[model samples]
Target: MRLLPAALSAAVLGAVLATGACGAASADPRVDAPVPAAQVAPAAQAAPAAPAAAQEVLPQRQAAAPPRPVSSGGASRAPVSDPGMDAAADGLRPFLLTPAEIGPEFTAGEEPRPDPATPAPCGGPGVVAQFPFAVRVGAAAESANGLVQETVSVYGDEAGAAEAYRASVAGMSCSEGRVDGRPAVIAPAEDLRADLGHDEATGWRIGGAGFDVVMISVREGEVVMNFTVLAAEDGLPALPDPLTVAKAGTQKLLG
Candidate 1:
């Protein structure tokens, strides 16, 4: 079966509301490549709709969009029961963060296939995901920050998972790299520390001229998960704590 690489087409470009112009009540920033608005999911998790008068006073932010679901062979966001695969071995869907876990400001992001120039955290000629599914969420595609991206690759054995984690850490130590199409510097994220409830974990800070990203990865048995949180043109306030978020995502994936 063909493995569907990470592609968050749903809200990849969701526009961050132009807060200052919109007079946003919350002290937060907005999105980068805004999605067409037509494809955004409902705002059930977003803050309650402001009173008409309140909205009138502050510029309205773009509606929050959740990340699109991913699965092997480009399957639907929702995980399905595959007769060939046991639920215990279903690695794609359960490895990702749930909508409720991500909160409101974020929307689904459309992710392009990895650019060859961009180095994978786990170095290799290329990535190998036996069964891969990914979710990328952010305020905007281009200029906003707090873009959270998670990709899970499940191998059939623990050794493969361990090697992937080791290789990714080695690859992630580079001094220079690219992120979200921008030139960036890669370094240890020493300040953003956390125990992460387990082992085989590491993190990096990718700094670009227009954006910054915090990337963390952890391995559980046959599964290795990577999390990247971006701070784009807007900022990071709109999103939740990166370490905290990663920890929660890890639990779900391992749970």
Candidate 2:
């Protein structure tokens, strides 16, 4: 999902920027390319003939490319969601969190749009590459015990949904750093029970520097769904279970 909203308790650097280690780790040992027997035979036969002036060439390693932001419209296609996101409403409504779900004082905020006054994670391509269509809605309250929740729905083909899922996992796995000067850390969920996505998922809790947040994103057939809930550290009722919210939304979206 996008990072925390401006209403976020902490004055963070925001969210989703510098968190975890970038690449995956491996344990296999590097092997050298084999030399032609005939080429090495003469050198072996002779007393290691005087070291040749020409040096043996080695394979060069290429640098890993940075994650490219997903773009829209090109020579071949109009855009991911070329026609528009008209059909996205049905898929997004289920995930919308209501004021009742939080506290009575909390009221519905503005619906998430392409360019909202507050920085929101509504862009499909940025978070999940090639997610042609997406929509989001949020709720907020300014009472002493405040709360914030944003639900995002992304629509695409099966492959697009999978790509989004992978990105979310990486985001949570590697999330760590300071936003707006407050510390942020994302730890794997200890008990995520939702039965959504390709396989069971690793839930996430984002907190530190007075911010309390929980997030989860899942993929089903052709849609990727995300839910994030936040509240001040000293708030009354604690943040509800994110997975529960996700399951409820998935049922409606799929139905």
Best by lDDT: 1
Best candidate (score: TM-score): 1
lDDT by residue for model 2 over 1-255, one digit each (tens)?
423222333334234423533232222111000000000011100000000110011111122111101111101111244334433443344434466664565555433222211111211223423333443222222223333334344434556545655644543453453221233454444334334554434445554434445555545554444454444432314444455656655454443
| Overall lDDT per candidate, in order of appearance | 0.38, 0.34
| All candidates: TM-score | 0.53, 0.52
Residue 101, model 2: lDDT of: 63
In terms of lDDT, model 2 sits at 0.34
Cα lDDT tens digits, model 1, 157-223, are 6675566555555555555433322233455434223467555666655433333345566666665
In candidate 2, what residue range of length 10 has the lowest lDDT sum?
Answer: 31-40
**RMSD to native, candidate 2:** 22.3
